[model samples]
Target: MNLRVEQRALAQSDQDDVVVLGPNPADTTFETTSTEGAYKILGVRPGLTISVFDMVIGADFAGRFATEPCVAIDFLFEAAGQGWLLDADGERLSSLPYRPGRIYIMAAPKGAVGFYDVPVGTRFKGMDIRVDTTLWQKLGAGDILSSLDEHHSLHIASGNGTWVGVLPVPPQLLAVARALFDSAMVENDDLAFEARALDIVHASINAMRSIQPAATIPPRDRRPLQRARDLMIAELSYPWALDGLAREIGLTQKRLQTGFKAMYGYSVYAFLQEQRLLEARRSIESGEVTVTQAAMNVGYGNPSHFSQLFLRRFGVQPSRLRPSETGKYQEAQAR
Candidate 1:
């Protein structure tokens, strides 16, 4: 993959409470080697302005829910980078990987960001996009949509502002964004790529708005289609059989394949493969998981096959992306 950055391996002993900022007084690259009971914040840029970019990762020690005390919103641009939520509503929260290309704007008072504390070794990477208020309102209507409250130590009051920057993306979406970005990086077509990426971004936002009522589309009307889709999404490992899923869903294999393709823009197998590859990508990005282990976790019994799939999905070999093995020129520089 064309990952622009790589972070140092996060230590297990790292705390889960406080966040670290800046390698030096003026440096924006924040680093923390421990997380025994605190949180950490890494900034790629030094000065605070209305606009900026960032790459961030977070890990929780107590559990997944331990991150609830933190509040930060990530913005993933179409350009393959994401921005971290730094100071929203006067408080700072650790950054984590969010869905790529999806617009998310959150504002909270202090303690709103506490939910971001993830387990040790968890890492998230993306570009940050920020804008001033004038530009934000132009994108869409601003409104107060949601609010969250929890432990006395953490509290958040949020409102949906005009999406200030780009949004977050899961690895599945990142694969698409990476492909688009690589093509742009190749032809030196920044303008074209940005436009296309923005179009995709708009489509995704519209899709987010297009939440159809499940009641309107009953299980009976789309039984076979939903069944295949559900099975493919639910089971990514251990060799999925078309006939088996079809039988379970009460449809012939041909019907299952055809219906799934017609409804979801992808064959069932292709969707499942993409999903598995996305999971593997996220696991490797976390740095705690090795390439071989990530491959197995995503259902590739053979490392070679996994590598091939990974390359096809992300345009990079799995070995090259893992944080454990370091030999490449760029990797050495990151350290």
Candidate 2:
């Protein structure tokens, strides 16, 4: 899921709290200036690297962050057994491990972010990495880049920070033992260039593994709720008014409404709307239709209606719900 995060720092008088990014209530671009605080977010991810395997192996990271000049401090962090901390001249000062339940923070000097080229080969798997630590903390620290499984995570507290480099991994062992060809082998290798590459790959995999699984509540046995849901999903050929669906399912509209709420955790109408919006997103992402066409195909006679629903469901407008857009939406949902 792709995430479009917009943050506005609160005034100094008020304890600063970064506003969560969501559907805006008024006519305001995310770029609008707010004296309240600095704003930074991941606007999009266009798959800068081509192949899935390449993304997994090389672990190329692309993102942005904002900082407060005076308050921010420059620091570098690396993982030593899951904990990460500031790397002060090759020595670990803090232990910021991969805690599953809590978010850890790292900060960098204002306006400084380190950029590096990570060559992830095809052997790495993106879904295997798990870094549940909130990306917001990472953003606050400056841009973060590292591998998933291996503790070789890297952090730049700001633009002023220097890299401690990718975690230790072994590359030369590839030719020695087939068993040493895994991500662990790479991470455990000599603490050099080849080893660093393996660490990057490991970090990426760990990150992929970190995301929570999709919600899987038991399906409702309630007939009307099930029937209404199935109909809405199966046939999106026409406008789906709530009354018709309730009637078709052989239940009073009220029963249908309450049953759906009890079972799906959303009202029947809302569930149906989500269904149509999801379909429209799929259509737009596949390049099978233009934004306008996607709206119409999903039974939204007016494009504005489609955009609003899309924004509500995925936190972005339908106009931006194409392939790259969909990926960002999906990634954000994972967070």
Candidate 1 lowest-lDDT run of ten = 147-156
lDDT of 1 at 65: 18
lDDT of 1 by residue, 132-151 (tens): 23322354512211212111
> Which portions of model 2 miss their true places by more than 4 Å?
1-221, 323-335
Candidate 2 overall Cα lDDT vs. reference? Answer: 0.37
lDDT of 2 by residue, 153-184 (tens): 22212223422221211122211212222322
Q: Backbone clashes in each candidate structure, one number apiece? A: 51, 49
lDDT of 1: 0.42
Which candidate should be chosen as best, given TM-score against the real structure? 1
Top lDDT model: 1
Model 1 compared with the native: what TM-score?
0.41
lDDT against the true structure, per candidate, is 0.42, 0.37
